[model samples]
Target chain A: MRDVYIIGAGIHPFGRHDLSGLEQGVAAARDALKDAGADWQDMQFAFGGSLAAGNADAMLPIMGLSTMQFINVANGCATGGSALLSGYWSIKSEEFDMGIVVGFDKHPRGAFNADPKASGLPQWYGDQGLMLTTQFFGMKIQRYKELYGISDETLGKVAEKAFQNGSLTPHAWRREPVDLDTIMNSQMVSDPLTKFMFCSPAEGGAALILASEEKMKQLGAKGVLMRGASVRTRPQGSFEVFSPSLDVERGGTPTEVASKAVYEMAGIGPEEIDIAQIQDTESGAEIMHMSENGFCADGDQEKLIQDGDTKIGGKLPINTDGGCLACGEPIGASGLRQVYENVIQLRGDAGDRQVPGNPRLGYTQVYGAPGLSACTILSAA
Target chain B: MAELLDKEEILKLEPLAEGLFRLDNGVPVLLGGKNKETGKIVFPMPSGAEAERFDVVPLKRTGKLWSWTVQRFRPKTPPYRGPGDDKNFQPYAVGYVELEDQVIVETRIMGDPDQTLKIGMEMELALEPFELGDEDKYVSTFAFKPVA
Candidate 1:
């Protein structure tokens, strides 16, 4: 296998947008190519994904009719991570010297409504109003809090920090800082979780240009080394979304599996990671993923958040760009947004929200429905 | 038994979906599927061609609340056939009830919204009116309530 580097990254601001999903995607792609000091024809291949947008390969006509392999990826919230991974593999395997990986999505306002029959679940599950993603997150955290003794205040703090960071992020959707009291007092969407703690379904696009070491040097472009990337699915007995039944015996989560594999692939432990961006679909998810990703022990988030350890300039900064909570989840684009934020952070170009002290290593994790998780590790080159 | 049927008839009762629950000696019992090879049990027993590989079995009526949440707003329709508007919709508790030595079934918890429910509390299966069906009958779905 060969080394892959991210020469450039770009993102269309996340939130409601007038442009179509494909147009947003193309804009990001063009910016990425420009940032890399390369042109559209320079990409030897492309990989992209979108949940609500049309096929990614369809961008060929709009992006100059270049005949390059463009594979479409669709892996729930891991769409962007998977696309990046595909591009990484193409370069690692020497199949392609350089390529573009992009993701974009525009969902209608409101909670995403899924078809039970399409997911192979009984229709009654949906009819009885039991098939909801919010309810699943609520129950999962409710149980975790009971077992781990996590406090409601800790949950509120997570959202408060997200908004605080979002205030500094130009690309973030929720740019205003929210107080802890306000977050805790917001309308209850599900028991123990309020409206302010949840990320709304919104629009956006992000793209990354990956190249081999040879290609990067040839273009005289600075780059970030793609150390590792891994995607894992739920194992049997693991609790996941949209389940009508759960096994009596609990099992490991996909985040745990993917995190473990990614650390091994990157040849580093979580402690060495200077800046991190794990999935924060809600406050509880960030708390849970903190332990799942091997950053901290279960129930330790309370102390970490209270001590401001996870905040910018702290020991281990997380979601310096506000994560899903502030950005609003665009499904396909959300994962790549993490990488884009990390790239800027690594380059020391994240204007106001930059993590103080030169950070060398950055990590990102994205998780979604049916219990899937994707993790990536990047290092400044 | 007759009183139960009278109450059902007054509401124009119908199961939300066929074969989910049935009356056994005047008591409603939820049906589950027991895998022939693995002995793994699943709720609402598999239907159609998939049903061929498992034996239909009655699930335990009593269990303990594993985890729960409340639906504070109306879910989107097409999948959700319940009350569409906020005026007609009432917040309801949803939970996973762990049946000892069997599967943990996701279910609606029948109770007052203001009443707080504790984890590991004993719960028992019951039938609740879900929504109005096409035939003017009230569709009944299975739910769990705190055991008296």
Candidate 2:
């Protein structure tokens, strides 16, 4: 029940990196510690998230810190969020006063080659061409469009916003703003979605420093209160990947369940959130997630985009530092990158893409493969 | 029948029904379990370990298309065992078929990818053959085809 606050956050940008995954982790971790004016010895615990690396905790050696409890976490795209949660719980339970959470990844090219057997899924599932994550996003949004009358232009607008924001961001991968027509004219990756709308596999690292309220006061550092942190999986009957068949009368998706839990724990509804960083593996994902995260109605994304409500300097600026759409999706670092952006926005450090108002409350949600979702609420202290 | 033919010969692989579909009077019908307590239905219901009280029942043969997407490109290897090389891979439609509001089966849509597939259109299950490897190795899979 103790309070947790994020004292510092850092990122190694989102794009191809020549350094190894652990190297990237070490870089981000070092920056985070420096930003907090703390040393490696101050960290009582550490959690690392990475998909392509051997073990994120291995970065401990590089930091010259040892004998500390370090756990490596991997939950697909939720890796970063899960790591942050682990660090938060470590402090919340009074088990540790302060900790570091780092997520980094170095991925290969082309569509992610997921292993069904490795993930405990039947070989037949992939053999029948059912395990591709791209197909899942495409199908999910296709259904959303059918039920809600969303159009390709609306989806294109989402990508355009992300790229435009990325262009202004210092560390974004795709820094050039793409035109709406260019996004729409891009080659088809799936029906209703073009190649330009999909996020590419990326290489990057992001890290956060979480400490108790007492510890922050000791350091005399300003920080953001970690009001809520939650992670949830799909309940039965929800339309999720790896689900061969769905119960028509099933339960809620991980995003819905996790968002609700996070809001309840934070003691704030979606209306209080001034900025957001959500999962946008593809353009349509942003559109669908806008509703899933309770930001808007189920079918109101077209208006949300057209009115520029979800853009920077608008009603609710989402992914102001560019999302996975513009940053590229480095599975492990993706979630923490969202938090890093929130921290920057809350601190009023984001120069170009800062929301017009002095945003006080921010929220982040990350959805992973095989149905796992996590969200965290941050408020300026 | 197990002792009768060459391994390379084409064979009707067991349907991917997992006891959910059967050839009843030469017609394929989906099967499911209706929970006695909750009245909830599940297709290809769990066997033995969790089937203490539910009855295995036959599901409706046809339903409407709920949602769909097309695989515009070939998926990666080590998992995808579809026919042909990536260069020759043809786009295919994938969708969910709602079976009488009881269950929605995720299935491959058997139709031309260029054709427009509207939601709420009637669809029926069809057992189809999927060739694997260079030889005659094949597997029988199930897909939902639009019903006239």
Query: lDDT per model, in order?
Result: 0.91, 0.85
Name the candidate that leads on TM-score: 1
lDDT by residue (tens digit), candidate 2, A223-316: 9999999999988767877666788885778999999999999999999899999999999888888999999998888888999999998899
Q: Encode model 2's per-residue lDDT on B29-122: one tens digit a residue.
A: 7677778898887755556757777788887879988888899888776687777787888888998888985888778887688787988999
Candidate 1 lDDT score at position A32: 89
Q: List the residue pairs that clash in candidate 1.
A: none
Runs off by more than 4 Å, candidate 2: B1-21, B31-40, B45-57, B134-138
Off by over 4 Å in 1: B1-12, B133-136
Clashes of 1: 0
- Model 2 clash number: 0
RMSD of each: 2.0, 3.7
Residue-level lDDT of model 1, residues A1-381, one tens digit each, is 999999999899999999999998998898889889988898999999999998888789999888988899998889999999899999999989999999999999989997998889988898878889999999999999999989999999999999999999999999999999999999999888999999999999999999999999999999999899999999888889999999888789999999999999999999999999999999999999999999999989889999999999999999999999999999889999999999999999999999999899999999998789999999987
Q: What is the lDDT of residue A185 in candidate 2?
A: 96
Candidate 2, residue A121: Cα displacement in angstroms equals 3.4
Grade the docking of candidate 1: high
